[model samples]
Target: MISCACPEFALDNNPDTRAAMERITAAEADLLAARAAFYPQLGVTVEYNRTNNPMYSFGNILNQGLFTNTIDFNDPGTTDAIQAKGVLQYRIYNGGRDAAAMDAAINREQASVFDNETVRLQLQANIVRAFCSIVQAEEVVTARQSALEAISASLAVAQARFEEGSLLKEEVLNLEVQQARAEERLIHARHCLSLAQRGFLRLLGLQGAAVQLDAQGSPAQEIPANPDINRRPELQAMAAQIRMLEAMVRQAEGGHAPTADLFGSYQVDRGAEFGDGSGNSWTTGIRLNYALFNGGRTGAEVERAKALLREAREKRQHLELACTLEMEQAVLALHQEEERLKVTAKMVTSARESARLSRLRFKEGLLLSSELIDTENRLTDAQLSHSLATASRTIAIADLRRAVGLPQFNHGK
Candidate 1:
C-alpha cells in the first residue's frame, strides 16, 4: 500500500473509488440474503367471512364451538366467522443446493472485495503518472527560462561588440533572432506547465481546487528484487471467481437430489363476533418432494454448470501466464529508464561545461558566433533531455510498483 501523506493520497474522494466500494457493500448484502435462506420462515394470516351455505355455515359454527341445539338442522345455515393463523416452515434438506448457494455467495463477496482493491490500485497509478507530469512540466519551464537568459546575455554581448566595431551588424542581428526563439520556447514551456497542472487536478476530481505539486524529482526508494505476481489483486479476484464457479456446479448437481421440509400451523376461529369466545386448532407434518423427471432439465443445468467451471479454470490459467509476462516487461522498462536517466544527467553536465568554454573563447575572439550558438543549443537540448529522463524514470517506477501490486508510492522516503 502507498503510505504517501500528500494530497494525492486523497484517493477515497475519487468517484470511481467510491463506486467500487459501493459494489463491495452490495455484494455483502447479497451474501447476507443467501445465508438467511437457511433459517425457518414464519408468517401470519387473518381472514373474515359471511356465508349462507348449509354445509360451510354448519362447519364454521362447529369449528367456532358456537353451534346451538335450537338451530334447525334441515335449514340452510348462516355464519359470520373470523380466523387468525400462524404458520412455520423449515427446509430440512434441499439436495444440498442451499449450502452450495451460500458458499457461492461468500465467494462472490470475496471477489468483490478484491475487485475493489484493484480499482484503488489503478487509481493510485493514475495519480502517480499525473503528479510526475506536473514535475516534468516544471522542470521543462525552468530549463527554457535558463536557455532564454543565456541567449539574452549573448545578444547583449554581440550588440556591445558591434558598437565597438569589433563585430559585424549581421552577427548582432543573428544573436537577436536566437533570443526571440528562446523567448518563444519559454512561453511554450509555461503553457505546457499550466495544461499539465489542470490535468492533474482533473484526475483527482478537484478540477476547480487550487493545488500545488511538491515533487521536485525522482523519489528514492528500495526496489524489490523479486515480486510475487500471485499477490496481485487481479489474480486474487480470479481465484475467488473460480471458487464461486465450483460452488455453482455443486448447487446445480444438488438439483438431482430429493428435498424434505417440516411445516406446522395454529389457528383461532371466532363465530359471529370478532374477539368473543373462540376455538383453536393446530397441525404439524413433514413433507417430502422429489423431482422424479423434468424432461432432463436438471441434467442440462448440471452440464451447463460444469461447462462454466471448465471455462473459468481455463481463463485463470491464461491470466496467470499474462501476469508473469506483464511483470517481466515492466521490470525491463524500468531498468531502461533508470539507465536513460543516468546518461541524460551526464550529458547535461558535459553540455554545460562545453557552453561555458565556448562563451569564454568567443569573448577572446577565438570562436565564431555560429560555434557559440551551437554550444548554447546543445546545452538547452541536454537540459531538456535530462528533465524528460527524470520524469520517465519516476513514471516507470510507478508502473513497476503497480505490476508488483504495490500500487501507492512510498511517501515515507
Candidate 2:
C-alpha cells in the first residue's frame, strides 16, 4: 500500500492569488485620479504678435496737431506679450454633478475590489481540484504496480509448472498475457500521475517553478449547509455596479441644475503714445450657468440612464438565480460523488481478494488459467474505478466550496 498522505495545496501561496490582491493597488490609483478633479487647474500662455501694417496710426492721426505734428511712419513695432495665471476654479455648487461623479468613481473602485476577490476564490478552487487529482493518480499508480507484482508471481509459477510438464503451454501464455496487461496499466497510471502534477503546477501559476508535491491527507471537512451568498464577491460586485449606475443617473440629472463658479482675471496693457501709456486692471465675480434647453438632449440622456438602471437591476436578478441553481447542483454532486467513493472503496478490497485466491488455485492445478486472467482484469477495473471515484469526489467538494463562496479547499474542520 502507498503510505504517502495527500499533498498540501492552497491558493494562499499561489502567484495568481497574489496578482489578484494587487488589483486593490490599482483601484487606489483610480481613487486618487478621481479625487484630483476637486483641485484647481493652472494654465500659462505666451504670445509674440507682429503686424506689418499697424492700425495704431489711426489713433496717432486723431492726435495730429494736438501736440507735435510729425508723421513718423516707420516699421510697425512688434508686440511681445507673456502671461501666466494660477487658476483656482472650484465648483462652489453644481446640480450635485460633482458629488455624483465622485460617488460613481468610488463605486467602480469597489467593484474592482470585489472582482479581485472573486478571482482569488476561483484560483483556490482550481488548485484544490488539481491537487486532488494528483493524489488520486498517485493512488492508481500504486495499485497498478501492486497488481503487476502479483501477476509476475503468478506467471513465474505457471512457467515452472509448464517446464515440469504439469501445466500446458496455453496456460503459461494466458498468465503471460495477464502480466503484460498489468504492465500496460501501470504505464498508463504513471502517465496520468505526470499529467496531474503538471495541472497542479499550472493552477498555482508556477509554470517554471521547481516544485514537488508532498501528499498530505484526505479533506477533513464536509460541505457547509445554506451558504451565505451575500458575502460572495460576485454579488458584492453586482451591488457596486448598481450603486455606480445610480450615481450615473444622479450625474445625468445634475446636468439640468444650475452650476456656480467664481472667476477672477487681471490684464496689463502698454501703449506707445496715446493717453495712459501703461494700465493694470483686475475683476472678480461669481457666475451661474444652467442648460436651459438642448433640443431634448438632456431629457434623452436621463431616459437612457434610467434604461441602464433597469438593465442593471435585471442582470442582478438573473445572477442571483444562477448562483442559487449552481449552489444546489454543486451540493447534490458532492453527495453523489461521496457515496460513489465509498462504494468503490469496498469493491476494490473484494476484487483484490478474489484475484489472489484465483491465482493461488490456478497454481495448484485446480483452477483454469482463463479464470485467473478474468479475476486479474476485474481487479484492475476495480482499482481504476476507485481512483476515478476519489478524484471526482475531491473535484466535487472543491466546486461546492466555490459555489457557496467559500475559499477553495477551505476544508476547515
Candidate 3:
C-alpha cells in the first residue's frame, strides 16, 4: 500500500456532506422568502372587455368619458374598454403573524447550519475509524508474515537434525505442521487487510482509487478532563428546532386576529374605439380581512402547533441526554484503550525477549522444538495485539473529539 496523507472531507466529496449543504441552502431560501413578505407588493394588470349589457355598457361609456344626455340609459349599445392598472399593497397589521413566520425561518436556518456541522463531524469520525482499521489490519499482516518466517526457519533446522538421526521424526513433523498453520494465518491476515483497505476507499468516496494512509502515529491528545457535550452540534440543532416550533405556535395563534392592509391603485382606461376618448383615475384605501366563519380551522392549527412545540421540547431533552451519554462512553473508551495499549506494549517486549532466548537455546539443542514454536507464536500475537491497541486508541481519541464537537485530529482546526 502506498503511504499518503489523510483524506480531506472537503475533497472526499462525501454524499452526506453534500446533502447537508443542500439542506442549508434550502433553509436560506425559505428565510429569504419569509423576509420578502414584510415589504409592500406592487403589481400591474391589464383588463379589456367588450359588452352590450345595459348596466355594463352605461358604466363603460361613463368611464370612457363619453356619457351624455344623448345616450340611451335603458338599452345602451355595445362598448369596448381597456384598463391598465398599477396597484400597490402593504400589510399594516397581521397580529404579528409575519413576524412569527420570520422568526421561524430564522430558527430553521440556524438548525440547518448546526445539522450540517453535526453531519460533517460524524463523517469525520467514521473516516478516522476506517483509516485506523486499515492501519491495524496492515500491522496484523506484518505480524503474521514475521511469524511465518520464524516458523520456516525453525522447521528447516528441525528437518536438518532429523536427517542426522539426532532429532525424533515427530519433532520435525510438528515443526512442519506449525509452519503450514502459520502460512494459513498469514493468508487470512492479508485477506482482512485487503477488505479493510477497500472499505476505507468507499468511505472516502473513492471506490476505485488506490489505498494509502498518512500513518501519522496516534493522536497525542489525552482524555479531556472536562468532557462537555454542550457544544455538540446535534444538541444545538435540536435546541434550534425547539425554538422554530415555538415560533410556529405563535404564528398559528396570530391566525385568530384580523389582518389590515393599505392599498392604492392608478388606472388608465381607453374608451370606445376610434372615439379619441380616455379616462384616468386614482384611488387609495385600506382593506381589512377577518376570517369570521372558518370552521374551527384556526383553533385546530393553534393546537397542532402547540403539540409540535411540546414534542420538540421533549426531543430536545432526549437529544441532550443522548449526547451526554455519548460523551461519557467516548471518555471511558479512551481510558480503556489507553490501558490496553500499555499492557500490549509490555507483552510485546517480554514476548520478544523470550522468543530471542528460545531461538538461542533451540539452536544449541537445549530447548524443545515445541517450546520454541510456542515462544515465536506468543511474540507474533503480542505484536498484533499492540498494533490493534494503538489503532483503537487513536480511534477512541477521534470518537471523544466528535462527541465534544471538536475537529477529528487537530484540536482547533
Candidate 4:
C-alpha cells in the first residue's frame, strides 16, 4: 500500500506550485471522461399503471360434452412493469467526428500541461525576484548603519570644536541633522527588509513560519546560449491551441459525412393472467444517418471553425513577436543595470575615501563638519544605488529566463 500526504495543507510547499500539479491531474480526469465515450451504455427502466376496468376474453373451447369454458379476469389496482436493458452501440462509421473529438481532447490536455508548466515557471521567477529584494534591502540596512556611525563621529567632533569656540553652533546643528537623516534611512531599510521577507515566506506558503535566507553575494551567472523561445511553455500552449482548433475544423468538416451505428438489446417481460407467462425479446439492428442538407448550417459551421483556427494561428504569431521583443528588452536592461552597478561600486569606494579624509581633516581643525557630513551622505547614496542596481540585474535575468521558458534558481537542490 502506498500512502500519500495531501499537499493542500503543506506549509513548506508553495500552494501555487501544488495547484499547477493539481491542474494536470484534472486534465487527466478530463481525458478519462473523453475515453468513456467509446464504452457501451447500460440502463434500467420501471413503469407502473393503474386501471379501473379490465377486459376479459374467452378463447375457443374444445368440444367436450357440449360445454363452453369462459375465462374471468380480475382488475388489479395497479400494474407494474420493469425492464432492464443492456445496449451495446458502436459507431461502425462516421464522417470522422469521433476521431476528431478525441484528437481535440488530446490537444486540450497537452495545452493544459503547458499552461501548468507556465504557471510554475512564473512562480519560480517571482520567488527569485522576492528573494533578491530581501537581500538588497538587508544590504541597504548595513550601508545605512555605516553612514549613521560616520555621522555620529562627525557630530562628536563638531561638539568638541564648538566647546572650544573653534566651530560655530550652526555647524554642530548640521551634523546633528545628518545623523537624524541616517537614522531615518536605517529605519526605512529595516521596514523594507521585513516586508520583503514576509513576501518571500508567503510565496513559499509558510505564513507563520520564520525564514532564514542565505545571503552570500556572488558574481552573476552567465546567460545560457541559444535559448529556444519557441519551446517555452507559453508558446507551446499557443501551439496546442492551434492544434486543438485544427481538430475542431476536422470535426466540423465531418458534419458533411454520413454516420452509421450498430446496436443490440435484449429484454424480458412478464404478464399476470389466468396463467402467468413470461416472454423474452431481442433486437439487433444497424442504423445509418446522413445529414444531406441543413440549410447551409454545416457550411457555416465549417467556415466558423476555419476562422477560429486562423485566429489561433494569428494569435500565436503575435505572441511570438511580443516574446522576442521582451527578450531583447530584458537583455538590454540587464546590461544597463550591470554597468550601473559597477559605476556605483566605484562611487561607493571614492565616497568612502573622501569621507575618511574629511573626518581626519575635521579632527585636525583643517575642515568643517559640513564637508564630513556631505561625504557621508554621498557614500550612503552610492551604496544604496549599488544595491538597487544589483537587485535590478538579478530581477532582469530572472525575467529573461521566464520569457524563454528556463527554470529559475534551483529550489530543489
Model 4 earns a TM-score of 0.86
How do the candidates rank by TM-score, highest first? 3, 1, 4, 2
- Could you give candidate 4's per-residue lDDT for residues 70-183 as a string of tens digits? 423443222223344466777767787877877888888899889888877777678778778877988989998998988888888889999999989998998889899889
Query: Please, what is the whole-model Cα lDDT of each candidate in the order they appear?
Result: 0.82, 0.73, 0.86, 0.74
| Model 2: lowest-lDDT 10 consecutive positions | 59-68
**lDDT of model 2, residue 271:** 41
Relative to the true structure, candidate 1 has a C-alpha RMSD (angstroms) of 3.2
Please write out the lDDT profile of model 2 over residues 1-413, one tens digit for every residue: 12222323444656666776687777778668767767755444433332335454433333222223454456333322223333445668888877788888899889988888788778767766776777788888988898888888888988999999999999889888888888898899899888887777676555655445555545454567776466678998999989998999999998898988877766544444444344445567788998878898878888998999999999999999989898889888988998999998999899988987897788898888888878877888898898889778878877877787777544441
TM-score of 1: 0.90
Q: What's the C-alpha lDDT at position 406 in model 3?
A: 80
TM-score of every candidate: 0.90, 0.84, 0.93, 0.86
Q: Cα deviation of 71 in candidate 1 (Å)?
A: 6.2
Better of 2 and 4 by TM-score: 4
In terms of lDDT, the poorest run of 10 residues in model 3 is 3-12
Which model, 1 or 4, shows the larger lDDT? 1
Q: What is the Cα-based lDDT of residue 31 in candidate 3? A: 99
Best by lDDT: 3
Q: Positional deviation of 10 in candidate 1, in angstroms?
A: 2.7
Error of 4 at 130 (Å): 0.5
